[model samples]
Target: MVDAAQKEQLIFVTQKSLRMNRKKHFSESRCLQLFAEILTVDSGLKPAFLFDYCLSNAEQIQEYVQELQQTGLLSENLHILSMQENVLIINLNRIIQHLERALQENGVQVIDVSVHRENPQLAETWVTKQVRAQVDIIWKHLKSQVIQTGESKPGLVTASEIFSSEWNLCTMFGFLLGFPASYWFDFNTSFENCLSMTPLRAFSVSAFCPRITKNLKHRMYSFSVPDILYLDLQSAIKTWQRELQSDFQTQTMFSHLCVSTESVCLSAVML
Candidate 1:
């Protein structure tokens, strides 16, 4: 039906069209894979839709559809429509309205309506004000109780004791790391006081017993101890002994004062 030259031209044209179609199909397949990867990392309708819109505009739909068909990756359940004159128009207004309704129903209030533009300083100020208001309410309740009672309740004493115990441990650790003898002496006094208290006695004993045993084992292994920088080992031991003696004196004074003053107060109250 055609001449030899015409036949050759027809075959060349057909091959070129096929090559172009294949290249376009590969590009679409790659774009779809990228879209899937993005969806895997972040799951949200707005983000997904934004990504899909971008891909659709960047790559032609015919090629994408052909790739989807070839790979059997087309989801029949998903209602994907081609952007044509016959199809419904999708505008930013409709998308925004839908997002607003959905977010509102889900109890998500959009404080900043602007997209991709936010004032960090204003946001920080707003957050700080909210936090301060909450803190003010807590302080108000505390102040009201303080005013009514004229003194904090006895429960605060337990909190103070816990705080002092932790502070003593920190000071002890610092003293072990080349602090002056005076600082170690102060920490030793606090530590001894903590050990004497009923609630804290068990913890102090547990901690100190393990530490002493560990140090003794290390000294036995090495047959020597590290040189003391601020205070000699002998001086440190003497300081600990002095703290113990001072604790005993404090206990004796407290007992005598309580026996004398408490009885006198009771007698006066009875009278």
Candidate 2:
């Protein structure tokens, strides 16, 4: 009983709605692909990562998290430390335990020149002292912040609280994220690092993560270290790669992830 013009208008509207739905679906799926890469945290390859919540709507974020949980991509050990601003800082609740295990198992030598540079006599014991001192400092800082914010427990601290602390935010995150050679500097004197004009290499690991959607492939994590330290950190880097590969083989979420790494020469002052 419908006229030709009326029928044409209805069909056009239906097609437009379908197109809009597809676009939304694609956008959410893309976000999932990138976000799900943080499953590396749960796998113990890394301790934490930052997720950008601004990339998707709240509903989409909820659904993405739900899907990850349902599929075990986001495990019980992993938790969001701060849901502030655009970036959500995700980390393990038992961070100290994780860091201790990573340090012991990977044969990573923790060295902090900042600790022993002032007192050269302490060089021999500095490495051991530095590890415990740094961990204690970070733990105490986090505990105080969590208590003040009432976020959760000592494990669930906020970014804003971390920023308010005396320690450098980037340095703290670098350690928490399990980078072998995190740059250390005196924040009181100046936040500037000595990497100016120095040759640097950007290291990135990427994978075709299909937990959310088959079409998504992108870099999971990236960081830069001084070219000079490449040799010193080579062992740690290899251990990290091996652990990632082990995860790819054993973890259900990382099946077919196809993780790979690339290094490129780059120069930057304020990394």
Highest lDDT scorer: 2
- Against the unseen true structure, what C-alpha lDDT does each candidate score? 0.24, 0.49
lDDT of 1 at 115: 20
State the TM-score for model 1.
Answer: 0.20
Across 36-117, the per-residue lDDT of candidate 2 in tens digits comes to 5555565555566665424543334434444445433344433444422324334444455545655456433443324324
- TM-score to true structure, per model: 0.20, 0.60
For model 1, give the 10-residue run with minimal summed lDDT. Answer: 200-209
Cα RMSD of all models vs. native, in order, equals: 34.3, 10.1
lDDT of 2 at 79: 42
Can you tell me which runs of candidate 2 are displaced by over 4 Å? 1-30, 42-45, 53-77, 83-97, 102-132, 137-164, 256-269
- Give the number of the best model, judged by TM-score: 2
Show the colliding residue pairs in model 2: none
Q: For residues 1-271, could you state the per-residue lDDT of candidate 1 as single tens digits?
A: 2234533443333232233343443243333233332221121111112123233322243333333333332212111122221111111222233323322333111111112222101123443334334323323433343343335332121000011232222222221111112111123332221111111100010011121122111100001111222123345434433433343353211111110001111111100
